[model samples]
Target: MTTTEHTPAPDAGIQTATGSHRKRLMVVLAIYATIIAAQIVGSLVTNSLALAAEAMHMAVDASGILIALIATILATRAASAKRSYGLMRAEIVAVLINCLLLFTLGGFILFEAVDRWFNPSDVAGGGVIVFAVVGLAGAATSLVILSRGAKESLNVKAAFLEVMSDGIGAAAIIVSGILNVTLGWNRGDALAAAAIGVIILPRAFLLLKQAINLIMQGVPAGIDLEEVRESIVDTEGVDEVHSLHVWGLTSGVSVMSAHIVPSAAATDAGEHPRILDELTMIMRERFGIEHCTFQFEEASHLGHEGLMHRDLAGLTSAPSVSGGQHVGHSH
Candidate 1:
């Protein structure tokens, strides 16, 4: 019998940008699962609300990781007729879910902490110490994974952040445990749990805001509509830019549309292409925007001057005019 060896072709897309993220997410998920199991065991052994809360948070982190992994997989599919934008928005949806989970987890912790404060309970020092150490290790591992591929996708980054926060909460639990063990301060554990909630709330809020912005079709964080308009107006042949709109399809990807009036000379067919190219280049280079739609036109071609004049009267009395017919451009 002859022996044969099998070789598999590599996936270019995965190898280039997404493989590392998938690997990191899987590793982090496994680590978090272990941490959750340990926490559940430790919580029962110690009768500690802090440990239980941390365990619950770990559960949320695990779920978030799974969501991210699914989103990452879906995002790799090619755009189909039914879904023109492919699956990029899936990551945003995953991010939204993660943030909501964190927020809910934070709320639960806060409620439990308040209850514990009203009715204090003893926590086991040994169990706290062990669980805290496990948490720290998990956090450290998550940090390593996130640092390695943080730039790959926002979804992965969100999962990393959830894990990181859980790690910090674990550390706080350890500190509280040490205090309880040495000084017989039962309130410390409750306080530590509350601190965990505090840590999570801000991060959750930020993620929620970002998700909402993307869903609402709001401009990306770093981009200014006014600045974009200024850049267009500053171009050599562009007399003015108006009806400007900017929005994000997802993180780090922005789409913009605007109307521009070209100078009289730019109305010449030859000059129009040059003007369009310059504006497109400026948007790409200066603003880091790739998707753009621009309508080139003469001032007279715009909607009723009276309406535009009325709209701009308070903002600017003088309406800059230019000459050109409408020409649409997109990238």
Candidate 2:
């Protein structure tokens, strides 16, 4: 006999968080739009590479928030036969695209800065400073709008970080502008652009790593697989555990499934239900794993199914059964 536990998709909570925070996101997006436009014009007027790079960065920030908004809508759709997890992974996919865009934008700015270093360009320092201050004001406003939601939502947290970083980038441009105005250092503009590019690269790489890990169904960062296995084995009625697997559906949601053979005493006394309760409670209270599935099998049943000694690969233990069955992958 096989037992399975089915729960609602893990993104249910995210859907609620997104709904409440949607208005704040739209407000920030509008602020970024105005800043990007002002910076672009400032770049053209001042002939400043740093101003141009900042405009591009602000544009990227706006696009990321927009994508996140769209993803929130898609994620709310109900699950269909073709999509078991609904569109919960849409958020991850959007993040992946944003990371790639950031990489391209950062690389382009870096290349421009290098070229400008060789053939210096004249910059209007006072004009660059004016635009940088505008960018800073916008960043500060967006940060205020996103502060509340940042604690509850990953999307909001990401947008908050982007805005915060761009604010620092604006400060860098301001310093460069001041250097140009006071000391006639045309190279400072290029140096500031290069600094912004360098700052973007590490953040893009880290986000890219996280998105790819989620897509590949790798274990989430905070979970210890060995500890989970050990906890299961330590349950009172569990004789042995096998076919155990744990993975995330998205950023904050985790799911697990396992097979366990009940001890002889538990089976004889028909205490399977009690054992299930204990195991489920352990998963929920200790591991924070609310979604779980467990199959309770007898020792002879395992031998019959040719699942004698196999466990989730690399786990330290094997299933106990009376008959001699091979140890390896089960068909």
Candidate 3:
């Protein structure tokens, strides 16, 4: 695999994104601490399953927050020989881990809900309500912090979405507590827990899928391969483009590489620089790709009429070596 460096946007300013992320992380840590304390107290006093479940969920939230904080710190580190990418993808990995944690918690809750269905347990309604209200406040704080930073970075955005989803879960628990208190509906508690799990499931899956795709070097979601090819081909000194690939190292940071055939009329050495400039601009403006590599070659030097022919006959064809055929090309 090849690596390409990015030139930060001029208007992006200096370290503003990192500063905003740090602020959000501080807020999240405070909120998580408060909620965990409240939930632990509520769980002890009421001995309610709902309160205990919320406490456990809060623990997961705390862990996720810590992970995000660490990721942010690592991401800001200057590049070194040991890790040249500067730990930018650490945030993406953190998001993936958070999603996995949520899914695991959801599964555990679902299993408990299934068992409770057969053998229901009594829950303290008043305590459940009180703690849930407190939890909602924490969730709301998290939402505000996350929303503020979501536009700044993809990792931060992912963390924000996770917190937002947790907030929704808190809201559901609150409603369940209310129903249990007023109507004496014990099953309402389990139902609410299950509902929380349900809400988290889709978001977890979505985040996990995105993280995996990034890890696999799949094309960034917003870029269209066909559109990229078309744009390159339309460039003034380019006859055609092929074997183009685009992917993200992390969100908002995309890299691309392609093979280009220089137009027949543009053979002068002076024209290569102009071609490169046009190709780079096209990639940035049309495809939101800032990092790119173009391998330029004259069409005649390609030793075939087109990319398809070169792939099928010129490159892949068997060649006599000694007295036998060499069947494949080695890098």
lDDT per residue (tens digit) for residues 1-331 in model 2: 5776654435555353444588999999999999999999999999999999999988997899999899888887888999987897888877887888889999999999999999998999999999999999999999999999876555676788789889989999999999999999999999999988988888788778877877888877678877888888888877777677888776666778887778888888988888788888887777767778999876555554532324333234443466434332221
Q: What lDDT tens digits, residue by residue, belong to model 3 across residues 1-331?
A: 1223354555653232434477777778788788888888986886555666667776776787788778777777777899977787787888788888889987888777767656777778877888888888888878887786777566666667767766776777778778878988788778777776676678778878888888998888778877787888777877766557788877667888876767657756557778787888778888777778887754334453354745632355423332122122211
The count of backbone overlaps in candidate 2 is 0
lDDT for each candidate structure: 0.75, 0.81, 0.71
Pick the lDDT winner: 2
Clashing pairs in 3: none
Worst 10 residues of 3 by lDDT: 322-331
Compared with the true structure, model 3 gives a TM-score of 0.81
lDDT of 2 at 79: 83
Cα lDDT tens digits, model 1, 1-331, are 1111211123333221333478888988888888899989999999888888888888987998898788777876777999976786787888888888988999999999999999998788777888889888988888887775666556666776787788789889989988988998989889988988888899888778878988999888778877787788878877766667788776656778776767777666547777777777778778867667787655654443555533532223333354223322311
- Per-model TM against the reference: 0.80, 0.84, 0.81
Cα lDDT, model 2, residue 75? 81
Top model number, TM-score:
2
Off-target runs (Cα >4 Å) in candidate 3 are 1-6, 11-20, 151-154, 300-331
Ranking by TM-score: 2, 3, 1
Q: Candidate 1: how large is its RMSD?
A: 9.2
